[model samples]
Target: MSSVNYYSPEGLQKLKDELQDLKIRGRAKAAEDLREARDKGDLSENAEYDAAKDAQGLLELKISKLEEIVGNARVLDETNLDLTKVLIMSKVKLKNLKNNMVLDYLLVAEEEANLAAGKISVKSPIGKGLLGKKAGDTAEIIVPAGKLQFEILEISR
Candidate 1:
């Protein structure tokens, strides 16, 4: 019932690396912390012990999420992509119809989205609305503020 998500090669690799780190180094760190806390004695009253256990639980949750993402992740081969329509990893340039302002954003997964880097999540309202659009197309996206019109100026790999 889980849908597969498309990720760029770099994004997929990053997820794999983080998952490995959490399974290896993260587990080791948690064990060490727990052992050290146990050495301090008084289990029920030991704040350090409680903290370590809480951390371990959080780490396990993170590892579980990483496993799920990796399980459903697919790498997008840029060349094989259809350039005629917008999709994940496509660099889209658009003009704000209201202000005639131009903005360029690369559609990416939520984990890889970084506004400072011009990467926007495909889950975002604007990105979702822009999906499957071509250059010279106009997309009207509904945001928390209201609907905004964006004219696609360019689409590139």
Candidate 2:
């Protein structure tokens, strides 16, 4: 069996929509490019045809990978999430012990992570360290730069 991937509802829907677009419009456009390239010149000397074929190959590979991900994806509901500890989909407020800086982060799946939006992937160093931590608990996370300490202030849905 394939490994199950967790996703939020919106993230899963976005993936499905993208896959649909690639299979429909993307494939059509690729085929059209190939046809146009083939009409341009002799097969052996046609660089455009070769390039088109390469592009089509890459597109098919992307579609196949996306199909696999969508097939195994499980969308998680956030309403019933546990607030006892930091987990996927948890909104956590932390205070940096060393610098006294406060930061907020939402733990989410890798595909749905957007640092600019304050969402961090559970697989990240700080996210992994913060997982299973309760309020007021201190976490000493080892990041790429070095080890940093953070105190969990709160955990919510």
Candidate 3:
């Protein structure tokens, strides 16, 4: 069974858009490729035809998986988020206890995690450690590099 995933409205819309594109443009491209491959040869000896079929199969599988993900996605209301503690969709400010450096991150669903954008998956080490922590709370987390400590500075939607 597929688990439900929570997303921001923009994130959900992006998934829906990708699904639509795969269903329409992606399928059209696959069909065109198959037609071209079929026109090129005798069925028994056609490598291009085989490759095209395999590509189409992979494409369909991707579309199916995407459809399932989109179907199970739920949009979270940003305006109603709790700011008292770190949670999904929470923008949190943290202070590294070791270096006294401040960092900002937004906790989000796994699919929407982008390190460059400062969005972390709730399942990630730091994100998991920060969850449910209120301002002024200290969290000790173990990451791949090593053990780190952070002080929660603030939490906001």
Candidate 4:
């Protein structure tokens, strides 16, 4: 069975849009490539044709995987979420205990995680440690480097 993944409404919409694009534009491009390759030479000796066929296969595989992901995705209702504790889609303000550096991160699904954009995957070590933690609570997260401590300063939607 495919596991359900939670996404924000925008994220889910983005995924759906990508799937639609792949099914239409991507398939069209693949077909055109095959046609161009087939015109090059005979099937037995045509390297271009073989490469085009391989490319088409890979495109189909990508489309299949994306379809599966979109089928299993559920959008989270931001309005119904609890703001008192950290959870998926929560914007958390954290204070590093060791260095006392204040940082902010938005907890999101793995697919939407972008550290540069201040979004972190809920499945990540720090995200897991912050889960269910309320403001003023301290979390000790074990990372590859070592154990790090952070105090939850605030939680917001």
**Top model by TM-score, which number?**
1
Question: What C-alpha lDDT do the candidate models reach, one value each?
Answer: 0.94, 0.93, 0.93, 0.94
> For candidate 2, which ten residues in a row score worst on lDDT?
74-83
For candidate 2, give the lDDT of residue 104: 98
Error of 3 at 69 (Å): 1.1
What is the lDDT for 74 in model 2? 91
Per-model TM-score on C-alpha atoms: 0.94, 0.92, 0.92, 0.92
Candidate 3, residues 116-146, lDDT tens digits: the string is 9999999999999999999999999999999
Among all candidates shown, the one with the greatest lDDT: 1
Number of colliding residue pairs in each model: 0, 0, 0, 0
Q: Which stretches of candidate 4 lie over 4 Å from their true place?
A: none
Candidate 4 scores a C-alpha RMSD against the true structure in Å of 1.4
* Candidate with better lDDT, 1 vs 2: 1
Q: What digit string (tens of lDDT, one per residue) describes model 4 on residues 71-141? A: 99999877777789999999999999999999999999888899999999999999999999999999999
lDDT of 1 by residue, 126-156 (tens): 8899999999999999999998999999999
Positional deviation of 104 in candidate 4, in angstroms?
A: 0.8
Residue-level error in angstroms, candidate 2, position 139: 1.4
Measured by C-alpha RMSD in angstroms, how accurate is candidate 3?
Answer: 1.5
Which segments of model 3 are wrong by more than 4 Å?
Answer: 78-81
Error of 1 at 22 (Å): 1.2
